[model samples]
Target: MTIMQEITTDSDQRQPIITLQGITRSFGPVQALRGISLALKPGRALALVGESGCGKTSCARIIARMDRPSTGDLYFRGRQFTSSQSSEDEKTYRRAVQMVFQDPFAALNPVFTVAHHLARPMLLHGHAKTRSEVAARVAALLASVDLEGQSTAGKFPHELSGGQRQRVNIARALAVEPDVLVADEPTSMLDVSIRLGILELLSEIKRQRNLALLYITHDIATAAHVAEEMIVMFAGQMIEWGDTRTIIAEARHPYTRLLLSAVPDPDRPFVPGESVEFLRHAEAIRKVSRDASAAIEQIGPNHFTRSVTL
Candidate 1:
């Protein structure tokens, strides 16, 4: 689907809610991200697509304040707030921007009951006071995630299904009333059928709360379900980005085309080996796409590409 500008109003087009300008990251000799630019509009989801180790996770980490960008300007609500952030500022940022990690099972504490898990964030962020208020809010949080209040409150992480644990993670992220939500490979660990439920819940929460979202995943096919805009990254650099519909319909970047070609088609059953072949070739594409290039070609409205020259 296309970016719903009609639904999300830009604040006089002065700035995006979250903006990363020329982001770059390096780990010793390895370059994790390369001059990447992205934005998260309020009340809309922006999907960052790439293969494993393509820097999608690194980008998510930077946005969540878990890691600092080696070179880039991160602007929150039009103000520059990079790694130099003060302790108080960092605390506020943590409350404003929350993250939902990939492994649902590992995210929550097995020893803690659901109530304790939910209470900590609400208490830490000063969202609720008194044990009575905390208990009340925990129940509400569980309900927000579509879990039955009474039953889910006492269950531990191990007691719930993969999908249930993920829902709790989402609820915890929401407990702080954050402005930006970053989810990294959130549905990859869930059953295929259950993934859609989580995606729908996220969409519902976004609309209801008007929270800007950064949805990071390797599955390009799933981007259309949650994100209105899209960015296709190859070897840590963004090669193509624009409206989701445009990218899926008219993918220009060779890497982007390679990704879409591998997605399963509903009209016909795909041969088992086809996707495997595409995945096997992914590394070859990244090896060549990693070359830092100064040139960028605008293919269409909100569509651009940085094709590697042979």
Candidate 2:
């Protein structure tokens, strides 16, 4: 089957809320993304995993309309949106797609209280027409993220812990009633202990709201926590993609295996000599996987891997 056919088949009965078809972006001579294609459906998430500079943010920016793709089309519910849209349409689109930025501290205004942060979006989006309604909605938003509506709503970004600040950011995103959520490494900056809590919150929100989520992270292991499917990108190309469990358990591509191997293994004791060998293997995989190739091979029922030009 062709790429479009595969998308259709995988989508099953549910239509994709957002679809990226053959998307590509370039800067001068450098191509940041190469013919990337994926779909995000309501109530489900697809994780974009790779090391830094693997074009993960570029894809997220395109989906969030923060940046435009140089080539290929972007669609919302089968309607092409790559071309310029009217003011009203643009406003609607922007409101539907909300982004939770990586940095909790930088995502919010230092001076604004958490209540203000959540209230502003509801007011601007017309979700709350009255001051009282805005206040109520802000309280509910804070509560959704497990924050105390009374105490937490009055605190500023600096007054909260990193995890709390991130929750506030998430609450801000939720305040808009977005159909899609692009969480770009939402927990990478937080302490390791708090990462799982944020991931769990995202999962809960996605199910409760039936929101399509695009989770971008360099840590492949965390993808399993928040996403139903996974796409492993390398050097601006999707090297492997499929069901998250299948991809994690039976990763076919060398690059995908390299990423899994990098995940800390608690059962295996660390050895001094093994570190050098691991580094050598990782370098070898990177060298080969960086080469561009268009050939795609189906490895399983839903899994696919791209060939690397030698």
Candidate 3:
């Protein structure tokens, strides 16, 4: 299957909610993103996976409109969003694309109650008007994320666990009825046991709301759970990407294979000096992956990988 075919997954023929074409972001001499391109269609999730400093957050920032791409075109509903857009248009785009940050605690206001956080967005976005209407909407939003409306509301951020706080952040994002949801490592700050719950919540919300989701994380293992398609980034460039199960089952790039190797094997017993050997192997993979090349090799019907320069 091609990207277009994959885009029409589950037989949905809707156009992509957002598309990034050859996106690049530069900070003076340093380039954070290199020719990044992907399309986010409604009712589908795309996972962006890579190690730290591999431009995952940069891509998310550009998608969220928090940062502009140095070069490249960003299209929303097939129309390019240019710098000349009116403030109202910009606001509309921002409202349509909501982001859930990595730091759940920082995303919420400690002084405000959960009701206040969820109510503010709905009120500002005209989703609700009267106080009663806002309250009802807030309760519905909290309930959607599996939080008990009456029990969870009226509590401050410090009063909630990391997982609960992240759920609240998600509810806050959904309060605006966004068309796209960008979750940048939403579970990284929470306990390991609770991470799966957050991922499940995101997947459920995406399917239920038909919201295009960009699930960005360094953890490749979680990609298979929440996303149908996946991209592996190395040194700011996409080295391999395609159908999540296809790539996960038959990864082609060295970096991609390295990432898979890094996933902990519960059945394998620890061997002495294994850590040293693994680190050495990782360094070797990184060295070759860093050698930039624009050559892309098609690996399968929907799978593709960058050609490494030896």
Candidate 4:
């Protein structure tokens, strides 16, 4: 039972910019995270999928340096980082990894315009100096996220739609020129019609900036849209993980199957009384998935699923 297994896609062979080895977190008597290990490589996105209270955001916070692991080591570019790191090193790590929070409106300053939100980070990170330079960088950031700089930048967060505000949040994250982007439920708050657009925007940003992206969400279906790789987590443990397409096509874990089953299939129209059966099956899967196991089985070249005691 290896605690750390090398998980890489065929397209991404480059070294991981960030790595988490056997990470665990505890809140007094409660365990928030359990033996988490994964790597985030540049130019690729890894989707951390799980329902609420499954430690997905905990992983993101650890990677973004918002919280420290109760156990396990964190590595940046293969070098182990510590809480006692020098101020310079801390600053470098913070700037290198930026987060796009779940609530787009709350993430921004209401008093300030969209341009202010984007330009402040650029100037603070030394990406821009003069006023003209800041303006240019702000416009460029907005443009990269598919937002029109002239019309969008001057508007307040309240003035924009849910999806547009989210785009602005992403642009603000990019303003720092971060190597790693941790997006926590980037589109869960937006309208369903616009969710795919945000997902596409994230995919494009990952490729163009060559960013090591950590996309956190409970929706497994959307994970396939943005991430090259995926990890399905349950009860603070990774139940299944691998290439996104592989897991979607052939999910081995019961919990993974339950999640996929919940996704509405256009081909399978709703039938009366099916919901009751699904709830019963879903409960059974949850009971089995709650039991943790250190052992894992390889399902494909890059895919793996935990050994569940059925």
| lDDT value for model 3 | 0.86
TM-score of each: 0.89, 0.94, 0.92, 0.94
| lDDT for position 300 in model 4 | 82
Each prediction's RMSD to truth: 4.4, 2.7, 3.4, 2.6
Each candidate structure's count of clashing pairs? 0, 0, 0, 0
Candidate 1 global lDDT:
0.82
RMSD of 4: 2.6
C-alpha lDDT values of all predictions: 0.82, 0.86, 0.86, 0.86
Off by over 4 Å in 3: 1-13, 268-280
Alpha-carbon deviation at 121 in model 3, angstroms:
0.9
lDDT of 4 by residue, 1-310 (tens): 4646546534567889898988999999878898888989999899999999999998899998989999998999989984558989998998999999999879988899999999888888799999999988888899999999999989998999989999999998998899999999998888889999998999999999899999999998889889989999998888899899998888778788778877786585223224545557777778888776546888788889887754
Poorest lDDT segment (10 consecutive residues) of candidate 4: 268-277
Kindly report which residue stretches of model 2 are placed more than 4 angstroms away from their true locations once superposed.
268-279, 308-310
lDDT of 1 by residue, 240-297 (tens): 8877887877877667867777777856422233465655776676666776753676
lDDT of 3 by residue, 183-280 (tens): 99999999999999999999999999999999999989899899998889988888888889988888778788777767786564222223545556
Scored against the true structure, residue 150 in model 2 reaches a CA lDDT of 90
lDDT (C-alpha) at residue 269 in model 2: 25
When summed lDDT is taken over every stretch of 10 residues in candidate 3, the lowest stretch is 1-10
Tell how far residue 60 is off in model 3, in angstroms. Answer: 0.6
The collision pairs in model 3 are: none
